[model samples]
Target: MSKISKLFKGSSSSSSSSSRSKHRSRGGPTPQEAIHRLRETEEMLTKKQDYLEKKIEQEIMVAKKHGTKNKRAALQALKRKKRLEAQLTQIDGTLSTIEFQREALENSHTNTEVLNNLSFATKAMKKVHENMDLDKIDDMMQDITEQQDVAQEISEAISRPFGETFDEDELLAELAELEQEDLEESMKSMGGLPSVPSSKLPSAWHGHRTTTKKRVEEEDDMHMLASWAT
Candidate 1:
């Protein structure tokens, strides 16, 4: 009997869980529905407040009309007015609270929408940045620069002057031969030039040297005459 009871309890618990899961699958009321409900409540509370206010005003008029004419009637009317006033005050408080609740709900709903938009924007930005990498960008730029340099070098090579080519040693040999021929030509030209006579010294220079030699000879003769006189 105990085992059968345990089995029944397990079956019941399983069914309850399945039912709960089914209930969970059914969606709850949305914020719009909740806000609508709040508005309905606010409307009801406002109507109640209006009714209480009207009733309080009617009791006041009755009390004023019966004033001093029927003291007991006036007193009873005033009492009724006070009770209506209290009810109106309570309704007013209820309406204020309802309005506050509705405003809070609206703010919450707006915040939810704003948060969703921000989340979407964040996801979009993340996706945009996903395909970008600093390292890859740097490598790509380097490859581009290298390609540009190679293109420039190729362009420069293609734009070279189309002139004769010469081997270095051959060019040097040719240059030496040309220089030798130039020297030979210069020597031939010099050979054809007028020659200076070996004895073509200036007359003043020759006179100066001859005058010096004669003065030395005269001095030697004077020395010989002095020796004879002695």
Candidate 2:
């Protein structure tokens, strides 16, 4: 309304702003500090309450001591005790309110921290899932399944039996019959052969002829053993 008042108001506002900045620079009380302050106040109130209780007890003793002897003194002591009791009641209420405030502040601080952590975790999960596409994953899995089926079919084809089946007994019977025919043909061919006369041959030729006959006999024995093994 006046220049002086306006100047005073502006100065006052500047001072308040400076004070707030100073407080901020000093790092104003956190929830923990506030809770600590409340606890200290609560403790102080409890101590005061105890002092009042003790005072009330002393006044009661004084009232009892003076009750029969001095009525006036006894009335004064009773009045003091009543006043002390009132103070104690007031302290109790104050302590209750401080404790409630401290507890609420602590709960709010804890909830704030929990919400911040949850928010951080949610952002991290969002970033992680940003690279993923469910449709691409599904398509890749389907392709893998098809490839596995194709591989299974190829494996089956590779392991399949390739030829017609024949009985072991029938094969053995046929081999024995072929051996019998060979034996009969050999016996007939030997029977029609002319025997060598060693007396008319040269000594070296006879020796060679004897060795050839022995070798032929050994070959026949080996062939017979092979047929038996088969």
- Candidate 1: C-alpha lDDT: 0.77
Per-residue lDDT of 1-230 in model 1, one digit per residue for the tens? 65435654765686567556655885555688678767866765676666667778898999899999999999999999888888788878888888898899899999999999999999999999999999999999999999999999999999997988878999899988876676556546545333435785689987886787678656754654454346
Total clashes for model 1: 0
Backbone clash pairs for candidate 1 read none
**What TM-score do all the candidates reach, one by one?**
0.51, 0.58
lDDT of 2 by residue, 1-230 (tens): 95535654765686568657756887676777677767766776776676778889999999999987899999999999889888888888888889889999999999999999999999999999999999999999999999999999999999999999999999999999987777666656656334767467888988898899889877875765575457
In angstroms, the error of model 2 at 119 is: 0.9
lDDT against the true structure, per candidate, is 0.77, 0.81
Candidate maximizing TM-score:
2
